[model samples]
Every structure is written in structure tokens, then in C-alpha cells.
Target: MLKFTLKRLGYMLVVLFIVVTITFFLVHSIPGDPITAMVQDLPEETRTVYLARYGFDQPLGVQYVRFIKACLCGNLGESLRYPGRKVIDIVRNYAPVSGVIGGLSLAIGFTIGILCGILAALNRNKWPDKLIMVIAILGTTIPTFVTAAVLQYLLTVTWPIFPTTGWGQAKHIVLPVLCMCVGPVATYARYMRSSVLDTVNQDYILTAEAKGVSQFRIVTRHIFRNSFLPCITMICSSIAGIFSGSFIIESIFAIPGLGKYFISAINDRDYSVVLGLNIIFTGIYILAMLLCDILMALTDPRIRYSNDR
Candidate 1:
């Protein structure tokens, strides 16, 4: 297990390095110059001075080396638009809002999905199952921004039950969280329902039923627990999606989060922030995968020991 973890961590570092390197070059390759974008009002002579000061006048290879060195030294480079502010500081300020929004959405979505799936599976071919299926389909089909706008119109504008935009109190979180969770919740519900149905037909489940175990015990203990392994794996991957969803939802709602920062970085052409954020997101995804692997090992005895052992 230790060796496996080390191997995964090594792979994660390699992936992060590649992502940062690609992002650095790609942002630089875009048409407009970052210095020009920042110093639009400055005279050409002043812009030239600014470019030279920032080493933007150097060759691309030289600039890349300088950027990498700065990154290694814990200097994410000064924001091209913000002038003196370091890119990392900007990311740190906004990441918490995204984290809260994404975390809550994941929890609520996963719970709702699991409950709906269990009900649909147990009531297979009945009205309850049909209702859940319809909801799941709609949830999957509708775009998140469309959902957010509609909810804003009905819940916030027409009814005035919730705030239309901005994040501060729990009330502000409600709409964005709902919008972010809907798609994943639907996907998770369908996956869970199918998995449960498949597990219920397995020989071990039949054996448990033949032993005269109560139906509730058979479903919860023998069926649900065993079937949950795949759901657990799905949940981990779903977390990455939650962060991506938060980017869109945050933009729509005007929430001050990492997503907002990401958008700002793109508009200002703050290459350092963009590269740093991408690296941060990639690290998060890899960490989540590692956690899932550990959880799998804990839950399944077959995975607990090294294959070589």
C-alpha cells in the first residue's frame, strides 16, 4: 500500500508539471500581449519600458525559464494586470468561497442521489420509479446556467423566496448549490439504481434471502453495502465535476470564488494566475483519486494487501 501510494504521488507530480508547462506556453501563445493588455493607455515608449521591466521583451524560452524559476521560489509572478500583487495571493483569497460552494453541493447531491436511487430500485417498474426517472432525465438534460436563471426568475424574482445573486449568507448559497448539484445528482441516481438492481440479483443476495433474513437487512446490509463500492468510486470523480460546475455557477451568481478569479485571469491575461490555478485544480483531482483508492482498500479486503505480497 505504501509503495502504491508513493507511485501515485510521483505520477501526480509529473502530471502537474506537464499541466503547468502547457498552460504557461499556451497562454503566452495567445494573440494579445499581456503587457499591452495591461498598459493600454500608456504611450508606446512607456509600454516598451514596462515590457522590458517585466522581462516580456526576452525570448519565449528565456521568459519560460524565468517563470519556472519564480514558481519554484514560491513566487507565482506578479499579476500582469494587478501590477504588484502576487498571483498566489489572489488565488488564496478566492479559493475558500469556491471550496464551500463545491463542498456543500457535493454532499447534498450525493445524499439525494443515493436516496432517490434506493427508492427507485426498490420500487422498480412502479410510479415512484417512473417519477424519479423523469426527474433524473430532466436534471441531466437542462444546462446549469439555464437552471440557475429559471430558478432565479421563479424563486428569486417572481416569488422572492431567495436572493437573486451574490454569496454571503446561507440564503445566497441555496440557488447556486442547487444548480451545481442537479446534473451530478441525476447521473449518480441512475448509476446507483442500476448498480443496486444488478447487486440484488447476485447469488450471494439470493443466498441471503434464502436464509430467511429480513428483506430490509438483506437490502441494507448485504445489497447496499456491497453495491456501494462503485458508487464510492463515482463520488470521487464527481468531486472534480463539482469544482468545474462551481466555476459556471459562481460566474452566473456573481460569487467571489476561484471560478471568478479564473475568469478574471483569463480576461486580464494574467498567465501566472491561470497556470497556478490549473496546477492547483490538477493537484486537487489527483488527491481526490488517491483518497478514493485508500477508501477502496479499506472497504475491500482483497485490495488491502499489495498484489506482490
Candidate 2:
């Protein structure tokens, strides 16, 4: 176990380095003059100063070496568009809003999804099951941006049932959070339904029924636990994505979350913000995968990492 964990940690570092290196080169290689774009309004002397200070005047190799060093030392550098503001600081400020949205969406989505899934499974081919399946298909097939647009149009533009956009107040996040959770609702419902169905056919379940076990006791005691493991596996595997805010959802709602700022940073060529956030996200995903594997092994004795004695 220790050996596996060490190997995974080593891989994480390598992946993080690759992400940083790629983001650095890609952002720098973008079309047009980033320096001029950033300091277009400044005087020539100030522009030169800004260029030198930020290594905009340096060769790519030199800039890359310096950037790597800064990253190693936990300095993510300042935002190019907003001078003197650290990328880390920006993440700290905006990440919570995204976390809140993601957390709420997952909580609500998972609950509703699981309940509907259990309902569908119980009903089998009845109307409720068929209707839920249709909803699940549509929800999963539809893009988040499309969902956001339609909701925004109907709830805000047409009916004024909710605030048009922007964050603050409970009502503000309703649409975006709902939109973000659509995928989860579809995903969980489908997976749980399948899982429940499969569990229902297991020999233990048949034996329980033959032994005169009540339906509710059989389902709640045996099937629910077995059926939910796969869902946990999915959640563990996708933990990193939980905080990524589904990209454009925040923007559609005009929320000042990390994902929305990330979009702006890319458009404005704010190298520090873009690179830092990307690396952070990459690290999160890699680490989450490692944790997921470890968790699976711990939770299921049937699982093994290697041939170690």
C-alpha cells in the first residue's frame, strides 16, 4: 500500500509539472502582444518597467525557469490584468462561491436523483419508471449551457419569476445551481436504477424473499446498501470535478466564481491566473484519482493494489 501511494504521489508531481509547462508555453504562444494588450494605456517608460518586472521582456526559457521556481516556492505571481493581486489570492476569494454552488447542486441533485431512481426501480416498467427514464435521458443529453439559457430566459426574461442574474441572495443561485445539478440528477438516477435492478436479482435477495422477508426490509436492508456502492465509487472518482463549477454555469448567472474568473483570465491572457488555476485543477484531479483507488481498496476487501505480501 505504501509503495502504491508513493508511486501515485510521484506521478502526481509529474502530471502537475506537465500541466504547468504546457499552460506556460501555450499562454505565451497566444497570438498578438500580451504586454501591449495588458499595458496599452501606460506610458512607454512604465510599459518597459512592467515588461521587465514581469519577465515579459525575457526569453521564454528564462521566464519558464523563473515561473517554475516561483511555483516551487509557493508564489503563483500576480494577475496581469489586475496588478499586485496574487493568483492564489484570487483563488481563495472566488473558490468558495464555486464550492457553494457545486456543493448545493450535488447535495440536491444526489438526493432527488437517488429517490427517483429507487422509485423507478420499484415501479419497473410502470408509468413512473418510464417517465423518469425519459427525464433522465433528456437531462443527461442536454448541455448545461443550453439548460442555463432556457432557464434564464423563461424564469427571468419572460416571467420575472427569479432575478435575471448575479450572485447574492438565495434566489440568485437557484437557476445556476439547478442547471449544474441536471447532469447529476440524470446520472445518479440512471446508475442507481441499474444498480438496484441488478441487486434485486442477486441470490441473497431471492433467498430473502423465499424466507418470507418483507419487501421493505429486503430493499432497505440488503439492496440499498449494495446498490449504493457504485454510486460512491462514481462520486469518489469525480470528486475533483465537484468544485470545478461546470464551466459556463457561473458565467450565465453572472456569479463571480472561480470558473467565471478563469474564463475571463483566458480571454484577457492573464498568464498567472490561467496557469495557476489550471495546475491547481490538474493536481486536484490526479490526487482525487489516487484517493479514490485507496478508498476502493479500503472499502472492499476483494480489491487489491498489487501482488505485495
Candidate 3:
């Protein structure tokens, strides 16, 4: 297990390095200059000072090395648009907002989805199963932005219960979170239903039934436990995706999250913020996958971590 973990860690580092390198170069290659974006009426002297100050005067290779080293040292560099503020500070301010909404959405979505899936599987070919599947399909087909808009209209315009936009109060999070939950819930329901169906038909399930195990006990002790293992991987991978997906939701709802800032930074050509956020997103995704692997090994004893053979 240790060897397997170490190997995965090594792979993660390699991937991170590649991502950072590619992002840095690609961002630099963009047509607009960040310095100009930051300071509008560019005086020649001021431009020179700005270039030197931010090390834009240096070669691309030199800048890349410095950027990597500074990042390794926990200095994500100052934002071009928001001068004097570090990239890490911006992330720190916004990540929690995104996390709260994303986490809540995932918890609610997964719980609802799994429960519906279980019910659907148990009542296959019945009306209840058909209804759940229909809802799931709608949820999957609908775009999150459209969902957000509809919820905003219903909750904010017609009813005026929740705040229309902005972050802070608990009420503000409701719409965004609900909007976020739609797709994930649909996805989880489908996956969970498939897994449950496969597990239900297994020989062990038949054996439990033949031995006259109570229906509830067979489901709780045998079906749910075994079937839930696949959902764990889906949940883990979805964590990172949910975080990224919030960009649209956040934008639509005016939530002050990494997603909103990420979009804003790109439009403003804020290089530091863009690169820093990209790296953070990539790192989270890689770490989530690694966590998923660890969880898979832990949940299923049949999954052994072996470096050899």
C-alpha cells in the first residue's frame, strides 16, 4: 500500500508540473497584456516600471522558473488587477464560499439520489421506478444555468423569499446550492440504480433470499453495502467537478466564490489570479482522484494495492 501510494504521489507531481508549465505558457501567449489591463493610461515610464516590478521584463523561461519557485514557497504572486493582494489571499477568501455551497449540494444530491435509486431498483418496472427515472432524465438534460435562472425567477421574482443575488446570509446560498444539486443528483441516481441492479442479481443475493433472510435485512446488510462501493468513486470524482461547475451557478447568482472570481479574472486578463486558480483546480482534481483510489481499496478487501505483478 505504501509503495502504491508513493507511486501515485509521484504521478500527481508529474501531472501538476505539466499542468503548471502548459498553463503558464498558454496564458502568457494570450494576445492582451495584463499590465495594460491593470493600468489603463500607460505612460512609457510607468509601463517600464510595471514590467520590471512584475518581472515581465524577464524572459519567459526565467519567469516560469520564478513562478514555480514562488508557488512552491507558498507565494502565488500578487494579482495584477487587484494590486498588492496575493493570489493565495484571493483564493482563501473565496474557496470557503464555493466549498459551502458545493458541499451542501453534494450531500443533499447524493443522499436523495441514492435513496431514489434504491427505491427505483427495488420497484423496477413499476410506476415509482418510472417516475424517478423520468425526473432523473429531466435533471440530467437541463443545463445548470437554466435551472439557476428558473429557480431565481420562482424564488426571487415571483415569491421574493430569497435574495436575488450576492453571498453572506444563509438565504443567499439556497438557490445556488439547489441549482448545483440538480445535475449531480440525476447522475448519482442513474449510477446508483445501475449498481444496485447488478448487485441485486448476484448469486449471493439469491443465496440470502433462499435462506429466508428478511427483505429489509437483505437490502440493508447485503445489497446497499455492496452496491454503494461504486458510488464512492463517483462521489469523489464529482467533488472536484462540482467545485468547477459552480462557476456558472456562481456567475448567474452573483455568489462571491472562486468560480465568479475565476471568470472575472479571465475577462480582466489577470494572469496571476488565472494561473493560481487553474493550479488550485488541477491540484484538487488530482488529489480527489487519489483519495478515490484509497477509498476504493479500503472499502473493498478484494482490491489489493500491489507494486509488483
Instruction: Find the candidate with the highest TM-score and give its number.
Output: 3
Q: What would the TM-score be for candidate 3 when compared with the true structure?
A: 0.90
Question: Which ranges of candidate 1 are over 4 A from the true structure?
Answer: 37-44, 242-245, 306-308
Q: What would the TM-scores of all predictions be?
A: 0.89, 0.81, 0.90
Per-residue C-alpha lDDT of model 1 across residues 58-138, encoded as one tens digit per residue: 999999898888878878776776778776787677777887888888898888998898889989999999999899999
Q: What is the lDDT of residue 76 in candidate 3?
A: 79
lDDT on C-alpha atoms for all candidate structures: 0.82, 0.83, 0.87
Per-residue accuracy of model 2 over 1-309 as CA lDDT, tens digit each: 787678778888998898889888988887755778765677888888878888789888999999999999988888888888898898788888988898788889888898889889989999999999999999999999899999989998899889878888999879988898898899999999999999998999999999999999998888887787778777754567765656688777888888878888888878778888887778777878888777666555556534134
Model 2 residue pairs with clashes:
none
Ranking by TM-score: 3, 1, 2
- How does candidate 2 fare on TM-score? 0.81
Quote the positional error of residue 36 for candidate 3 in Å: 4.9
lDDT (Cα, tens digit) per residue for candidate 3, span 1-309: 777678789999999999999999999998756788676789989898889999998998999999999989988788888789887898788888888999899989999999999999999989988999999999999999889889989998999999989878988889888888888789888888999999999999999999999999999999998999999889887888655547788888888788888888888888898899899889999998888877777767677434423
Task: Put the candidates in lDDT order, highest first.
Answer: 3, 2, 1
